[model samples]
Target chain A: MTDQTTNWPDHLTGDAQPLEVGILLYEGHTALDLVGPYTTFALAGMKVHLVAETLDPVVSDDGGMTIAPTTTFDDCPERLDILFVPGGGMVYKPMLDPATIAWLADRGATASYITAVCNGPLVLAAAGLLDGYRVATHWASRDQLARLGVEVSTERVCIDRNRFSGGGVTAGIDFGLTVVAHTLGEKAARFAQLVMEYDPEPPFNAGSPESAGPEIVALRTRFMAEPDTALRNAVSHVLEQRAATSSHPVSDENADPAAGIVND
Target chain B: MTDQTTNWPDHLTGDAQPLEVGILLYEGHTALDLVGPYTTFALAGMKVHLVAETLDPVVSDDGGMTIAPTTTFDDCPERLDILFVPGGGMVYKPMLDPATIAWLADRGATASYITAVCNGPLVLAAAGLLDGYRVATHWASRDQLARLGVEVSTERVCIDRNRFSGGGVTAGIDFGLTVVAHTLGEKAARFAQLVMEYDPEPPFNAGSPESAGPEIVALRTRFMAEPDTALRNAVSHVLEQRAATSSHPVSDENADPAAGIVND
Candidate 1:
């Protein structure tokens, strides 16, 4: 994809196969966030692999889509082209799971792209990958990203080279398409989009918080009151380094978030 | 489900645990056709049990997603609220599998919705479900639908009550959105649409056979030459037989194709 933000992998391991897209699924995670990008990347002909902490099923937040992982963290493919992180109400738990966080951080160290949807970027922030980088995620998590020292935006989708971030679950398609253009090439991306009839016409106009109008946003925001507090308190503690990392290089463990995290 | 363009089960075992979603996976089936809707119902809190004919990993047409199934046909969930029929290039093989066709026909007789995507409607047609009903399928399959005596259109999505039809792979999202609207209340669906940010704004305006421009359309048309011939012949064979049921009765093998199916 020769788009505004992309970097084609320069080399491929003989057994590397095609670009492998690994999506992490867990309990209470929003199913749409994972499935949306799965559709887009799979449509684009990328090798999309659904992964979990174990071989068993990873249940979604609402008790929807129970996906069985093809491989476990211990048996993931040698590497990944893109690592996708999806959000749900229980993200705090998954983020705190050392196995899950280490997997994201380890993979992000060398993966072609590390992306997140909804509040998923928070996980990345907690992992220290977002330090000194611009990122985006769900609008509700925008301020938290600023607190993590990353340039955050309310855009429906953001593609910052190796860091792909989406506004919400629906942005997965756009993120996928854009990533497709970046990874496979524009022609192939266009070809896949054409075949899938990706030209979407939403019956209603509302989508993002900014786009969904006032009272609706207020009601939605009000609904999320509990999770917001939980995220702030839980994240501040579990991903404790958020305090240190924000004030210092991600490598530092004593940085003060209040003093160091960016606001403007 | 009341429309009865297809069969509804005689004694549907409303057992919640056993109802499974049998997703067809093979090379060339559009990826989104399965995954998009997979998450939709999954988010709505339904257990989307993935079923295949075998235990082998299923490869998609574009070689993108290699999905492992939860169960095979024989071992699948016995009772179900929905027997989702995902569409793609592999749909043609369902006609070749009496076990699958019979399973679809049997489960469809009782399941809540016998939904299909892209060319999945053809599987419904192959199972003699679309007979005498206004059914929809992929845009490229319109002519084949006409040959089968069903009214055809290029609408991005079509929902004939029990038989939800997605226009193409990407239409799965729209279909899922519509399904949420249908099964759950509009409020629940709207809530999902809001979280998903489902107001899709594709970078490119190409998604339909007609909308894909003439050259690309012609290329696709040429590419489909072989499938068209086979589909035409197979569909004709599926169209044979004489009905013996009453005017409003169900499960007439030679059911009229133009009657039960509605025009939207």
Candidate 2:
């Protein structure tokens, strides 16, 4: 073990201003998606606020845990350094909620960095924040994101301008570190990684459909059929509203044929 | 992409019984440690209960988040398939609490699988459950575990008999999948992995002291000085009490010289 008394490098010890992070919390959102980044930012001395529609305890999708939100949408700070959204099984609920869409639009417009993990980009896309922007989301939800007019990337973490997104649940950790490296320098991100022991070793190589084989992928498709159907409906609703408000009527050249269709 | 209509293999869709998982929640506990495993097990179809001293919301160590426990210790099931603990900065408080230690001792005696992540093993050691058992804990807390008479292993996840212990905060996810693979079979674990997209790509290669370099390690040590000091004091208190009650007085041959001394 290294000596504990050794002086750290100046880069690692510089006094930096704390970042103001706002993480959105909705009923049935995945806990890991929110907690992964929350842990990373909090460990790096950032002030994180769990923002929700209300201040009540928000229950996760599995109904196994409840997390209390620190601030409500109406009360959250207007100018946030980072505004994040986490995805879950019932992610379509938020995508279809006008209030949630309005909140995302309002906060995302002024936030220095707009971010999401897993299917969270779907919410942002539905709120028109990801219009014509390159984004990443859960592999299973990529079709839905593409349907919403966002250029989807399958990379674990994707960054386009001020918008950052990660694929699936566990990718949030890597995404958080990437954000930290970008905002606070690589040294700060490395220090956070060390403290959290971010080294990973998956016992199996079936984390993705390409590696899990066709059989497992089919099983997941069967399990996710209902949610996929709901997402398709939600995407159609959002697109129709956008088209209706357009001054120019929808035309074959301008309209996307696959806008509402669920790609198999 | 694989066809969504493809039939899933019988081996992947077996009718398996859901495991009952009990996760301990406490004041000042790390959010990621608990949420990592909780998300894994829940996604795998396990019935998870966030067990705590009370049903009220438990505030995390960072003070930015609060998690609600589903069931109190007294109301928890008599026999759980898995009993889990998560570690954090204030882990010593639970280690020193007689009620918490007694509860762990009682539940651990009957639980089919006793497990923990991060410094959680320290509490198990304090309860005398880890006596003579090889365990894994956070690297920084190894000396404290040794003081409790438990043999420490540096592996990220260690399994001695039925006690499963993991390293630092993020190790909970890997440890959870290991437990799932053991109890539910590799197919189930692999499916869970796919669902959560557990593929990790760390932005930095600084997860351990050796990998993080001396400067980063020293920086962490400086940041952790106060917690380390408190942990040493707690270890000393537990050790002195154990020595006073021993009929055979503490001897050089039988006692650990490192006991009550914080190893730097």
User: DockQ (Cα-based) per candidate?
Assistant: 0.31, 0.60
Model 2 agreement with the true structure over A110-158: per-residue lDDT tens digits: 8888999999998988788887778888888887787777778888999
Pairs of residues at least 3 apart in sequence or in different chains that clash in candidate 2 = none
lDDT of 2 by residue, B165-200 (tens): 888999888998898777766776788889889889
Backbone clashes in candidate 2 total: 0
The DockQ-derived docking category for candidate 1 is acceptable
* TM-scores, one per candidate: 0.75, 0.90
For residue A82, model 1's alpha carbon misses the true position, in angstroms, by: 3.2
DockQ, candidate 1, vs. native dimer:
0.31
